[model samples]
Target: MKLRQKAYALAALLYLEFSNRTRRSSLAEKVWEDSSAEQAMTNLRQTLLHTRDVESRHGFRLFEADATEIELNRDLTIDLREIGRIRAATDAADLATLIDLYRGELLAGVDGLGSEFGQWLSLERTRIENQFAIQATEAALRFGGRTGHAALHKLAERLPYSDTVCRATIELLRAEGNEAGARAAYAAFRNRLRHGLGLEPAAETAELIEQEGAAPVGAQPRTPARRSTDIQPDDTIRPSFVPRVVLLPPLQDFKQASIPRHLAPALVEDVTIGLSRLKSVSVIAPHTAWQLDPFSALDEVRSHQIDYAVESRIAPNFTGDGLSLAIRLVRAAGREIVWADKFAFSALSAQERYWDFTNGVARALADSIETAELQRERTQRDANAYSHYLAGRHNLRTFDLPKIRRGRKSLRIAREIEPEQASIESALARSYVVEWVLRAGSDRALLDKAKLHAERAVSIDPNDGTAYRELGRVALFDRDLDLSLAHMSMAADLAPNHADVLADFADTLVHNSDFNSAQEKIDAAIRLNPVPPDEYLWTLGGINFFRGRWEEALRHLSQMRNPEPAFRLMAAAAAMAGQMDLARRYRLQALKLQPDFTTSRWVSRMPQRDPADVDLYIEALRKAGFK
Candidate 1:
């Protein structure tokens, strides 16, 4: 679809094509078929040159040609080639790759030159679709028991017209006793077929509807092991455990010898950049790490959910140009020093020297962190409830309903296993608070559920900021602005370096009509969270909206991963700015998510200290067609 020119599209189809390598003459015939032989040759030559130029500008070599033949670059990897390889391979390990590679119809709606190219595309598309059908069927049977039931259902939706895939997915879900899921899958497929292709699924698929499984649905923490044992695969969802590291600001006068103040920040920045480049470790952004002094650094690191701290201090030697630097790699959880060393280097005035020193330090630190994490993992114990709690926390960050429900279930299991885990309790309570805010028709019952767990969590551990944060969010939605601010303020005081809490507090401030304070908190949250979660965008968008920056608000909302509620918000902002057509468009988009959504139920109780802002919000909602 991105192909700009007719020639370029044809060239791509031929060069990267499966099972057909175009001869130079055939390519010329297809692209310039109407021209004379001489003219065609000239056209082909110019097209290839221009195609090569386009590829170069994009920084990738996609095609190569000899005097008589053209082919895709041998070194370059393409999904079609990989799919072919996976189809031939018998190894089950490759099935995952196969399923992922079969990402919709090959080139979807892309068209090619003249009749020859079109014919080739049609044949290839059919071939690829059949192959994917086989792969998804095989994978569904293979991995259905290993994970959730959504995988197969999603695969069925990818090629909705295929009776083969639809039958396989429906059967899998039915076999798992998920009749609702099977019926939902069938209906989704039926809808796709009717709307997208103006056809229905096979009559056999109609039979599946009576049996069930048709609905489509959408939507971490802690701990230490008690003993040395092999780590078992836990029945929880979490990212692969990788060591997260943070670099402290280098101390300039630990030895009571002075170095230039600016030099420490610069060298620390260089070291942070180098560490960040290591693929094995997640480095805390230097901006957040800089907030930590040596006294409070470890506590802050642990609160940020980082595993290791690269603590370093530089001191000038009294008599020489050389500076002495001490570095320690610490395990944040246990406060254990995993690795430590000292070195001497000349003051790096030359850029080359500075890079050489910084790169070495980074590699060494990264290597040490990796080794330490591996050592810890090798001695890890059987999976515990804490593992599930951590998994739940990770899922909660996704900010979608399916994931939220999945996470909440994990936390419930965790609490059942370890009733005393304050963190688990807090996390479960927060899930309720989040559901109350985001989900349609949220009621006081959800707040009651949140209150029980949050209070219990706070009772169990009075210092836990997460419990307070959940309480704060609940109060904010209830329009108790003063109560909400009080609780959220305490959350920040207890966990100042926590990006999640800070972002939530920022959102609360916006609802309370305190835009300036909200801006400051949101900025700090962004800096603290190097990889800020999608929820942060929604929070910042709210701030922009209340601050009378409609376009900026829309910009933020547009970047969200799930933009339903955002579209509703965008509609209001657009209408307030007198962009009625845009408002209507956004309103229609939001209605697709919740057809009966009304401003009264959604926004009437919004916490606001300013009467004018409240009136403005009401006017905008009406203007956006919200009843």
Candidate 2:
């Protein structure tokens, strides 16, 4: 049987017709982000040609396009036109008709419509749900029972976290003496709410069940305010723009107990608290977890609008090594385990072991979350400043000037939106350092500005290691080796596993004549991030230079992203190895980047401790033709 296929076609149709005029390039890029501009243009042409064919073959006139622009045919009828008109009407009959017109979400059953399209769909889907919810609620109240109750049920499910609808539905069910049915509806709503936000039913909803005095044992009401362990409903009606993370109950099995099971809630709490501290993430409470049925958790996660989930389990090791705690972090869209680790500890007190394990996992989680969420931010079409901040950080990893400037703007926008966010301040500080060192080395004012944000980042949250790392970089650029190492060391202690922190510390170590330790830390940084940033390569090259491995130094520096620094190092390394021709070639490259560079001035600015080594560096650069 032939199945219907309309999503991509409709998406193309709508995009061409939405604004009444669109560039074919813009449309293609929106519809196919993975495709090249040339490919996108070709596909756009083919699709427009195909739409024209459909008109001739099936007698449907969707739209038409020219080389650079597309405009919908004036006579063609659009479904959205009808939806918009019906939406504005005040009559119930029109609302019902509008509701019926939404058979499903726009561009449904579509795949790979690019991030821009996905964003449009997300906003449109949200708009549709909100409008449908209001109308559905009103109709449910007006129609009364059977159909009204059914409409209420539909609205309740659509908005699983809504307390008002659930309470109303329960009351209506109770009024009809359908106590069993009422109980079933409340359970489903509670399950959905718990599954979505890890929140319990509101106090009012809970009282509805107990008022009858026939409440089940599991449905017992809480007499006091919310405890730390309990999940609370969101203050917002819908999920916010930040990446929403949910922590599920930690156990070896749902049907079977793991380590007596009582310790599960505390462990989940640890994860939730750790994730909650990051300004970038929005964490669902552990209280909303632990109690929900494990089988139903996955289905409810989507309705909750969750991005990632943290789950852990403990079991005895097969090798008789006591037990292992296996914690996994997964993204909802792909269910991919972005990070996971298993820790083996002696069967000591659960509380003590939990703290020890969580400390390590929490730090690692912070690092891994940055990487995962950055990926998420890239794919988000309607991401907010937090998302912009993530994207900026990711781009800044390259340490290039154009990208750095772009990243700086993103971070500044993020800071403006969330002035109290320490992470954005840290990132903004680092970007300033990059811009100052690479683009405006003579600009003392930029250094001062960078220092302000670095200090502010620390003042805002003294524990944020990235803040200290940036402070160290600022000091390093200012040639204050002692202060640089001091801040960097503190950063290492605070964020021992963060790749950026370790890399920054390694840079400070190189300047302080601690090559061996620097190599160790930088290598560790590389192991933590297999694709270490370009700055890591620069640090590694510097280490080899001090170790007198000229060939190795040249090899490492040659692969650095920005060839200016790479070429400068290469010139010295080649001359030190007595390769006159290669030295001349590299020196020419370095001079091309900084024509004013001279051996006397460059050597004087060197951070090396030994006068003899400084003399050696000058001699090498002179051999390579630095004036």
Candidate 3:
């Protein structure tokens, strides 16, 4: 990259990694600060010349490009991309590869890299390292005996001071029928600790090694810890999660009795559908509220748990030009009028009225759900694919795989039309996540494609939640819990009430061994939409298992009719609860569904909250007749 080209590329990547949907002018400003727009364009042009495969008008395609925008190249073999892929792999070799691939901080030597970009890269690096340490420790514990010992030893050598790895070494020795050796290992670790850092082992670690001299035949399993009291249930009933609403039919006063009777209901339906689109608000059917006929509108709002009540009136213009409409938004809890507005528009034909009503209602609801100060601009992308992508996204929420596939296809077409459309690329990437979860092998390539697309999306529109959400899914699959958490949290902050955003956040929390917080989030998800799919319920069961509430887990797991791989895994948890018969039955059923199901495979699937929990699960699975 030439100096100017390098500056532009660096600026583009910085914006891509940090900003949300940056405009060309904004990017130009950053690249050519204090310079005129013409100069900025000149510099941008120079930057484009660095990319050998890109055309001049393509606007520096990081991934791909089209007429309006340039995005991060999805097929580009960037270091961050490789890091994400390697981090997600479950196999030891993949983990090793990930450690190797995460060579240094992203864009390490780029002089003009913004502080925000530097911070993001720093945090990402920390998360990757933490995950690497945790996984290495778990591997050491799992492969401490027989031919696996060398792997464990290697892992210990790589992460010398990791308490988890050190403890794993001690446990491994004990498992191999080397009681004296186990004691010696623990003593060595203690001596190393005292000599190197002059600190004692953690309470749990000290207890584990205390009985080292006369080590038992087998390692005793540690009991699950109780949840701390600081963790409380998130039952805050905000206006956002309320499902019911009441709308007074628009009352019209006209001198001539020529008004259509059906007009009011049509307007009511329009408003209802518009409000319902907002995940936060659920509008009560007009018919139900009309039938109730309370003493006053406020009474109706109080009785129905309605968060907002809308009342409207229409009047014919005496000049025979237009109709005037008045609308009011009232707070149900306080019976206080929050916002009242009036709109006047030219009298329309019946067909125009129908379209106007829908558009008007949609705009109003959109305004209502939106926070007071917008954090990010919700400007429509200059790509037709965005519309198709949105429609596909709506369908994906229903969990209809056929519909999701169709949506993915629509996104792909959109991608073809506007290849650099970050929004579409993000949507396309998320579709891959769904496909991957559903076991669609043909769509597996989409996962890699999705990561690249998501990276590009973020590059193009760093502030867009969709891109972050897609990237988070990729990170989750890669088992990079830290990156997953960061991305998911960003998505949630950007779109707080979005169901999928909350669900992904909850899932990451579960994987990170924060089950208490995960339960709270799952509860929030259920409250956001009472009837979440079976997968969400299955995750709830996993949360219960981690929290040591086996019966609760079994209860939730039972709700899943067609058992997924995750549901079958719950059988091992059932065994931990001493429900051996039930565990055995579920295990057999799971094995029937997945003949390859084994203790090792099932244990590996589990999110390692506590190493003892892993052992408990393995022991339970073995007892339940799984190999």
Candidate 4:
């Protein structure tokens, strides 16, 4: 029932900690850091054998280790992975299970394997503790009333030194009118802080306590406790401080009794899911939104340190036959409505409109939040990383060569500040792709760098769709059309709600000559992003060009404010349409941007599903006077 050897325990723990396959060399290096490579390999093999023996004796297979790699049995039920359940749980019983599952610190009595193992264990322990505290506090806050109070109290007892846990416990007690209980919780926390760490309760925590008058029982410190200036005022312990937003449940307008009862909640849920898929913003859970008090929403926003609030109201439109959904994006700092929009739709219409509404609201709110963040003051270095990221994204959207370079510089700084950020890595990958494409694939090194960043992004977070899309683009440039299609398809599957992912997928599909499917994908993307970006327009134009709709291609291409990247394609499309004057003009523009651009060389770099498509493109380009 127990692993007698520390090495056996370490072997099993390594497999349990990381769900992915573990290389034998990596396992050896981590467990036997002081040993020679050969000795470490011998040690790892012995450890794995011992662990296997223990598992077999218990009549269970914990892992399978081959000559080169080891992987935990996917079907084996491990209590440690239950940490994931804690974050996903919304009910009291499920929330309480976290308390049971996390009996104590991970690998409680196991010790002193190696420096590598020790460092890894130390980081894992801290991560577990922080994750447990944050998840418990969020669960307690979301499920209010007696159940929530009990959960918070248990959380506070479990992690007494965690300021976030203690604050949540106090806040819940105060909200429930338990003044004495609130004061006692605050007093105990304050005393624990002073005694354990020679620190005091944070200003915000003490302010909550002060509002309830002096502690009734504990003796106050002789010298007033000063707040620590180093930590941010709210939830600084959270790993990622991305802009937090809450989409409040839509309020019903009784004046519109004809509106469907389910429509408003459905819209909110759609928008919530859409926004959650995006890396730009972190959304408050829909359950939390449903339970939030709209009357004192500002107070809730302040309590949660939320950056933006999405409030909606459903009412009868001017025609009375359709329902009007009014959405407003409010900046939490000043409580000002920065953006607002209203969508009118009939109940009989297809649910595609529902997605349209979701996409429009989510995209606009994310952009508005980014704009607000750029103008706001950054209080910490971590905050600066986000500012640089936003600025980088803004510059990249301009589609100008100099601006794109500036964007890469900003992204590099952001990546330097936060090396583990998948979004930053993904953006860097995109910047490289843009540069590679802008230069007409003249520099293969840019594609290599893009691939590296994209690989890193996916490695950091496999669920990041943009990373996959960038990886797919790199594959396309490498002339691996099938691999490009696979990665792009995965990206779309991973982020179905992301307009950018869909647009990118459509663009890749065009190269595969799936014209109808590509058009459908791009159309859906444009639906989601009604005011489409230049990339979306270029994708649409490309699809049209391949479909032999030359005039349509030109129409979309001309709409791009900076159409330099699409100039060659525009010239080809115009020439194919027999517009000789317009084709020459566009060809001149393309040459102005890249004087060395040649049809034969450029066509060689392009990926296509059929060689005939390549021939067609070359013919059109040559006809347009592109040598």
| lDDT (Cα atoms) of all candidates against the true structure | 0.64, 0.62, 0.57, 0.70
TM-scores vs. true structure, each candidate: 0.43, 0.44, 0.45, 0.43
Highest TM-score: which candidate? 3
Q: Candidate 3 — which residues are off by over 4 angstroms?
A: 1-234, 237-306, 309-387, 398-401, 440-446, 602-609
Worst 10 residues of 4 by lDDT: 229-238
For each of the candidates, the C-alpha root-mean-square deviation to the true structure, in angstroms, is 29.6, 21.5, 28.6, 24.2
lDDT, model 4: 0.70
Cα deviation of 41, candidate 1, in Å: 49
Give the per-residue lDDT of model 3 (tens digit) for 1-627.
245446434544544443424445545545554466788766666565555345345544463334345555454455555644542456566655555554443444554533333333433333445455555556545534552466556655655544565667777777878767777666676666556544333334555776645533322222112224222234443422233446666566543335544444444543453344354444554444555433245444443335556666565553465666656665443333445566663223333343344444344444554422221333444334444444555445435678778878877776776676666777777777877777623344767877988899888777667678888877877767788888888876665555546667787888788887887777666544444556667778778877778887777777765565554657777788888888878887877767876667545554454577677667767877789
The prediction achieving the highest lDDT against the true structure is: 4
Of the two candidates 2 and 4, the one with more favorable lDDT, higher being better, is 4
Better of 2 and 3 by TM-score: 3
Clash pairs detected, candidate 2: 198-288, 231-287, 231-288
Candidate 4 residue lDDT tens string, 357-432: 5555455555666435423411233545655665676566545679999989988998898888887899899999
**Candidate 2 positional error at 315, Å:** 35
Point out where model 2 deviates above 4 Å.
1-388
Q: Rank the candidates by lDDT, best first.
A: 4, 1, 2, 3
Better of 1 and 2 by lDDT: 1
